[model samples]
Target: MIKFNTKTNQRSDYLPAASYSLVKQINSRGVYSFCMCPGGVIAPCATKNNEIVTNGWSPSQRNYPTANSGIVIELKVDDFKKYSSFGPLAGVEFQKNIEQKAYKLSNDSQRAPAQKLLDFMNNKLSRNIPKTSYIPGTVFY
Candidate 1:
């Protein structure tokens, strides 16, 4: 995994549990992994209303071949300068836009946009994507 951090603190010996309790406030953004599923499969996380979101969960034994984590980046008031006119609702608007854009880019389907790991880092699109654990599947974009 590609870890990005400049911290020198060693991680706790305890097995990391739910991320809901952990909050990292940086640049007015609450950065945390939403659901951490070790040895789990990525699930189709769209709501009944037809919005695309991704989530993962593992069995108690965590014996699956794959593991996934949903990292969430929350925007704070300062990050909504362009939408300051919306006041407190700016963040909501921004999130809605992101979901809508993802739906549109994926041809209004449940398929999620995906790219090769190396291709993504090199800023290039892969001609083909490897198989994924995502059930709804992914469309290389």
Candidate 2:
């Protein structure tokens, strides 16, 4: 099945503006790309307790149909203020809230919420979900 990751409307090019720019030491958190898997498959990342996370993996031969990666975004300490009741453990609470919400949306199972790329872009529900590599299954949104 085809998949598109980003929600942006702009088209992409082999070469684009700002393609060779880098800014450093700005005292602001930056996003980094990591957890890349080449020729891999998406995997269900969930606890037995029912939290939905998406991860990816490849076989020992690295011969899967797709690739996946994680874009890590740095969160400053100040960003945890909304979760301050738990104090320094706010980040944990924040993550828990996300997992809990996902479980609630996915019928309290390990299944993760999903939508077809076109339906997502059109802001409508997908009448049919394409086959996925994930084994835990998906709950279409």
Candidate 3:
């Protein structure tokens, strides 16, 4: 998931809220954006203990100062082959593993692990992270 500070962009304040969908192929993998929300907040949506998952949503008025979205990569069954021993539940196990790992990375808290967009693209750790709409907060990683 990614988010941008809408408060810095004056145009976003007067324009109607919008959502976007983007699809592309990179390194033979399908990458796409899902549940894009203008003037939205990143929300925690974990369904189990020792795990973390996130989603985004906007209020009816969409007046928040941030916009966020989930960028997902399409996964094929082969992607979860490591958990194939679980049969049909392999994908579930794979997803659980990722969520649990994220939880651990965030110091076993609700705070999500995060890196600035530029730092991430540059493959470096962010020296600081700006404020975000995530209620539980975020920890630069």
Candidate 4:
């Protein structure tokens, strides 16, 4: 019954009509404002694969559009239920696993698999583990 057209009607490149108008109003000669940090400090946001990363920018200083691209894979309703073991908290669960694995391989209790400066220089794992990123939420850990 559903036609499922392959064609898409995407109108937004990023900003909407009203947002563009606001920037037009403020681009004056004496504005003298640069290095404009919009929502400074990166946040630990994840993509579909759950690789945590941060994003932020400085205007005038960076001298470019405050934009960062993300690689996202599309999924359907069936995709949501794909991971049979992770019935509900799939994303959170996956992060915990990463931390735990990284933790056991880590030196300190923080739970992030880490190597020492000398170990890194020697290209070896340190016998004395240093630190980890695993927080209190790792129930399985």
Q: Which candidate achieves the best lDDT against the true structure?
A: 3
Best-to-worst ranking by TM-score: 3, 1, 2, 4
Q: Candidate 2's residue-wise lDDT over 35-134, tens digit each?
A: 5555567887666476788887766545454555554557788877889999879999888888888999998887778777558647899777776777
How much lDDT does each candidate structure score?
A: 0.66, 0.67, 0.80, 0.36
RMSD to true structure for each model, in Å = 8.1, 9.1, 4.3, 19.6
lDDT of 4 by residue, 1-141 (tens): 212233662223333212111111222212221222321322333343323333344333332323322222333445445455787776556555554554454332332333454575476756774222223212121
Highest TM-score model number: 3
Task: Report how far off residue 40 is in candidate 2 (Å).
Answer: 1.3
TM-score, cand. 3 = 0.79
Better of 1 and 3 by lDDT: 3
Candidate achieving higher lDDT, 1 or 2: 2
* Model 1, C-alpha of 57: deviation from truth (Å): 1.4
Please write out the lDDT profile of model 1 over residues 12-83, one tens digit for every residue.
333344444345776666766566665578777665444577667787656565667665668556666777
Model 3 Cα shift for residue 68 (angstroms): 1.3
Per-residue lDDT tens digits for candidate 3, residues 34-132, read 766667898899999999998888887677768787667789988998999999999989999999999999999989998876586578998778888
Residues forming the 10-long window of minimal summed lDDT in candidate 4: 16-25
- Each model's TM-score? 0.63, 0.60, 0.79, 0.24
